[model samples]
Target chain A: MRMNLKGQKKIINIETSQYPNWKICLINELKNLNSNNVEIDCNDIDLSCTDILELISIADQYNCKIISFCSRSIKTIVSSQSLGYKSQFIIKKPSDNTLKMNEKNITFSKSHFHQGTLRSGEYLDSPGDLLILGDVNPGAKVSAEGNIIIWGRLLGIAHAGSKGNSQARISALHLRPVQLRIAKKVARGPKEKPQLGIAEQARIDSDEIIISPLDAT
Target chain B: MATDTRVILICSGKGGVGKTTLTANLGISLARQGLSTAVLDADFGLRNLDLLLGLENRIVYTAQEVLEEECRLDQALVKHKKESNLSLLPAGNPRMLDWLKPDDMKRIVDMLKEQFDYVLIDCPAGVEDGFKNAMAASQEAIVVTNPEVSAVRDADRVIGLLNTNAIKPVQLVLNRVRPRMMANQEMLSIADVTDILALPLLGLVLEDEQVIVSTNRGEPLTLNSVNSPAAKCYLNIAKRLQGEDIPLINPAEESSGFGAKFRRLMQTKIF
Candidate 1:
């Protein structure tokens, strides 16, 4: 735990590799803290809303208040935010292997894979690339720091390069999304129906988002 | 006689999509086939399954009393007047909504399971606490949706929630299907809906005026108007629920056939 210059608040890092049980490790760490107000840095660990609530209650037993939360996991950040917590989304940097692969002009990152249809009001976020095997229904959204590849239709909103990497692209078997966003650019989906059986891809070209048939890359 | 009672939740996230209608009709159709069915109205705020089954005036004790131990399970269960095999369990007053937990719902369903072969829960609209409470006790679900974009979208959201909750074998029932509109490409086709929701099509209910009439009369169409197109559809859905191998009616062929026209003419005149 590190003390900030502001108040007597402490910052605690809950690493997944530190203990077999993250919750137990966190509790043990909280017990050793000298400060009552604490900020938790949940590095690369996913915590649901209930899990966050349980953690807060556990801290309460030790007379410690969780002032804020920071996580590298988008799920954890989203859950914490939904629970009215001040959370920070630490953007995951490209791994060493990805940087090494960049020398060969092949930039790659670990892709998140989802298998079911994302229905309305559902939102999916991936720190790296995002791959979905089902359709993204209208009113739903999927965003990624890297590229997004959908094996099914894209009827919802999709944002690639969410962290401002404009090189990212979004492709789908049927690319008729409600809206498409690439880095800083945004564009409404085409009104006319796309030809059947043709896969499409959307990307930024000349500072504007453009949709076209998936070309052989 | 409650051997392997199937607790099915009939739900549609959007309101006015025929979740209660399907539950009432399915309960009656199942009862007519000699299987004892009990439909529990989980929509405590707007409970109307009793009215649809014409058991509104007969309800004295509700599931609330049963849970509170003020009355026996049979006392709360209002058996249908015409169909002795079917029964309706009305929910308590709206005040019960504040205190009724998912555990309470499961307890009520467990009690119903002991005496009936089928326990169909008429789920409330929206995926709020009420819907969650109703969904808690259900082993499987029948997601009802109309042939409209908004209804299908809501149904999709509900299906996604159901899948996350590990509710298996969740089937789909396309309600209020306008065959003519579907053929004219003015309405969402069966394929358009199924392609999005991605659930097994259990049955389809064609839009018919008799449904409104039957509903207003506090009598479901399957009770006395089995000849009505919508009633036949409800009966077919009931049969399909019992694992009968009945092929789904093709709406395109149904709307175009001369025999269907004659049947429609006769239904309007004779009934």
Candidate 2:
């Protein structure tokens, strides 16, 4: 009889201030670990520019992909992303005046607001929801774990419920995306004329994501 | 120093979009108006700007030689025979591309801008490191695209890159436009291209066979005296670039294919 067993994950609880230039210690520790999946606990760790850079470099060195982050500082979460790590860092509230990173238990009020046009080749990824005030031009991308709302037209690619919430929806003032994704379902923009609408919303209905005009009533 | 030199990059995301052709003719046109213009080919391995301007055989030194300190900056400049004010900065062979850094490109462009009124960098096709090098010192950009949907799509991608890189005042130049096809509703109109790219139209070039003739002769159509249709288009583009109020040429009837001309002849009973 085969039994269902769970694989173990390595968690690094770092409060890097204990050592000078804590990145060296972090890299050393990461190098010693055999697992490629790492859960970084950045509790009370001051994630300065260099610190985040080092973290990303060390993570890359070990071919380690961040599974999750435990952080209280919101800036650290943003820093992690800015440093080119797409791993969602969960905010465990503020600890020692520093925001941190996390997991399946918490989504951390996942919502991001951005202003201005997202040009082609530019990518924006959020842990929760994403709201863009300007157009998402072609070749650009916006991905979020929750719903994505674009105040302007959506000409680029957008992925909602990227972390696999089938109910995630994508809404826009003018929807004509190159591609759209909701959870596991993928849909290409129609080859025919786009459905004219003032506003449109795409949500998972039954097993498939459906795009329809928002009800005025 | 004169009003902060303009280093404009002529880029097309897709190849064969007439980037080299535009660079050569526009540089000559600007020179004809008594403005010192230098066209630099930054396409690295693949380059043809010199051939277009009839200055290929006159290349004594290239950018590679300059970078290697084998020649001075002025030594690599190939002066146009007809237009002494215009010059060509030939690109290095593809082998030297590995040594060309972004900062190196910017430094060379800055140096060229100091001596010329208009420094036009002809970028390589595709948005690769070569493209980045060409864009390093450019303050303005002209995205060239054909009227075809595929070319328009690629041009849109280049425009996005320019915007993200903070290249201000990006202007679009619609090239090889066959208005006959537009009349048949088979090709995208200037309006359609601009609407999708959302950029200011700088100029339009009618698809003319003379363009090929001038290119093969190693002479810019703008410099030719054959009443070349594409020549007028390039001259107007140059005037617009120099802040002249030259009206944009209406390329509608000029783009009419052979059938329209034959039909006109039949209507006039001259066929």
Candidate 3:
């Protein structure tokens, strides 16, 4: 957690994923401040209306007035807004995943399989390799610590080797994704459309992410 | 007749994409087919389903009063002036937004399910509390979207939410389609939209001027203007909802049809 002090207003950005114990962590942080207006950045944490109310009551005990709320989660913003709090919804950049990877450990022993289309704003994350039987529509995302494979089209974002496995590859029947990521490298999707009926694969080649047709020889 | 009632939620994540219009027209069309239908306006905050159905001035009590035990359910339901089988139950006043919960929505829907064969809930825009409340009472959904990227994107998001909530058989309706623009490759084609959304095409509404006129006059086009292109589409949708086999209208053929070609030739001022 980072706290910035500026003229009776403190911006508390809870950057850690404390999961179930986030309230306790937030309360401990709030104890340090004395009668200051606070702005919270609840990045990617989904908070409900009752949870927001609990946050307000906790802040009341700390003499900290939460002036505004900002989150990358639509649910959090909606809940905070419903409680009559000034809230802002922050949109995450498409390829902004490097910072998030530092906290998660890579696991490549298991393979996860999903059977349906992943629509916009939906996310699928696997600890190991990820395989999907249906299309990944635009604005959807799938990430894995190992290889990623799609039996159908991949029109959205896919991140392979999310925890810095440089050898992990992403392959699909149609590889026209909005963005592709392999370990630490990120590349925009190919500008031109792929030839019909040809499956493609993307992987790191000479430190650059490159796309090549999956040769089924 | 089907024994179990069908509670369908008509929702579009974006505003002005014709959720209320579809609900009103579909209600009338179903009622015309001798089935009792009730349209629940879940968008009480910006209530306009009553206005579209031309029952705005006739609403005495709303679902809010029924839930509060201030009025009977039948008293709150306003029967259509022309369509005797069609009824509209306005949700509540704008101030009732704060206290309205998903349970209240379910209670109202449960009560309506007992009296009507079909209950169409006109959901509000945005995937917030209002949308959730409307969604809670629905078993199936019809996601309405325009032939635009933003509208399709929002519909895709809403579809994802519906799937997570276990709403089955979610269908798509591509609204406000201009055949000329679609045929000329100027707008997103039917294939392009269906490819992304990946839902069964329920029906397509051709862009028609009569829709605006009907809305202003508080009469759904399907109620009277059978010749209107959009009205035919709405009737087809209602029939399809009743499990009728109707082939979807082809926008390519519509744009290049003989009548359209003749109209184009006449507008050239060559005569």
Candidate 4:
């Protein structure tokens, strides 16, 4: 099925073999299309991977822009490149990239640039290691499944091992936050003026988030 | 030249930190001081500022209505019956979040700035779309927290966001502080909270049951002068925001009296 809006055409193709919901596949296909001007309604059809790949191929053939895809099966979409999606598709793990590491989980460590200061109510969720060069200002939040390293002063809310990895940790040059969460437990910081001049790290210690000075030893 | 309206945002990333209560009382306090004040509830999904202030029944229209162009902005504003200078722009119905666009919010804030001396926005909990909407327009912020670790942690997160966003003059309001708990080393102290947050302290509110009662009654705690310690703190916060040189009242002293509370807090070694 396909729909066109305001000069932007959305061609939605679906296959209902693996999944029962065609609407979900249609939504995913539309998202992979990547055109903001187009609107799609896929309430009636079920979708398959072949159908999605075909849609992407068609989009490429027609040079049509795919805007956004909202899907319930985030893991499936992330693992398979069959969606032919682009533009920082924050996914758990892309199956195409799976050839590199199967024994240990690979941590992606690249700084994500947020143009303006993070305001209250903004949150960043990443799967691998996160390096925020900017300050973690108050009210902003950063959470990761792996370790979180902040080069700037950490003031906002941060969570490491959001996926229940107790070994994950959070580190910052200046660590002072409203709250710090590791795995499931939450902890607040050095209840007094943090003695500056030393780097700090926080990790879960027996179900409690403990903040201690980084050791040079 | 027109005076720039003071935009004070009451924000805390942690939920149930009395942010809405603080916004309502601070608005009432400022209005009682003869300044025209308006409290804007930015908590889109769950708006309780109207109920907390006992203005829920009087709400004829809401900011959502204004945003949808269903009514004029003036029509959505509900005036406080007792205080002529105090008014509220309540959050719209459940679907209010959908209609809340950033530019429309900015327009509403700009319009409020033109009419009121102070515009206090009660920010929603968490760092998400709702919070971004509230902080986008504010010039200053007040992070509200309790004397608990979780609340403090959330406040820290909020402060970081404000700093990153370049929201100037961010201050801290330490709410629901129990002096007895702090004295017993069961809860965090004022110095401990300030040290971790590293922001200037604006006011420290004591844990008073009267605050909850007043909220339940839909009357501002400031109106319950006899039993509300939180009211005094809110009043002082208002004065401080207005650039008044009011002395900071020590929470320990109010709870345990000056000498005993000081001695007990000193024993905690919170310096």
Candidate 1 per-residue lDDT, tens place, B1-271, comes to 6879999999999999999999999999999999999999999898888888888888888888888899999998888999999988976776656777899999998888889999999999999999999999999999999999999989988998998899988999999988878899999999999988889999999998889889889999999856788999999999999999999989998788889888778877865
Off by over 4 Å in 3: A1-109, B261-271
TM-score of predicted structure 2, chain A: 0.49
Which tens-of-lDDT digit does each residue in B1-271 have in candidate 4? Answer: 1277888888999999989989998899899999999899889689889988898888888887787789998899999988889889976576645777667678889989889989999999998888998988899999999888778867877887788889989998888888778877789888878766777888888776777677788998885565345677888888898889888876556567676556545634632
Off by over 4 Å in 2: A1-110, A195-197, B1-3, B251-271
For each of the candidates, the C-alpha root-mean-square deviation to the true structure, in angstroms, is 16.5, 16.4, 21.0, 18.7
What is the total number of backbone clashes in candidate 2?
A: 11
TM-score of predicted structure 3: 0.75
DockQ for each model: 0.52, 0.22, 0.62, 0.06
Q: Could you tell me which 10 consecutive residues in candidate 3 chain A have the lowest summed lDDT?
A: A100-109
Error of 4 at B197 (Å): 1.0
TM-score of each: 0.77, 0.73, 0.75, 0.58
Which CAPRI tier for candidate 3? medium
**Candidate 2 chain A worst ten-residue window by lDDT:** A96-105
Q: Candidate 4 residues A144-193, lDDT tens each?
A: 88788887777788998889989888988889888898988888756576
Of 3 and 4, the candidate ranking higher by DockQ? 3
Worst lDDT 10-window in candidate 4 chain A: A37-46
Q: Cα lDDT for residue B20, model 1?
A: 91
Candidate 1 wrongly placed segments (more than 4 Å): A1-110, B269-271
> What C-alpha lDDT do the candidate models reach, one value each?
0.90, 0.81, 0.91, 0.75
Q: Put the candidates in TM-score order, highest first.
A: 1, 3, 2, 4
For model 4 the TM-score comes to 0.58
What lDDT does candidate 1 reach at residue A178? 94
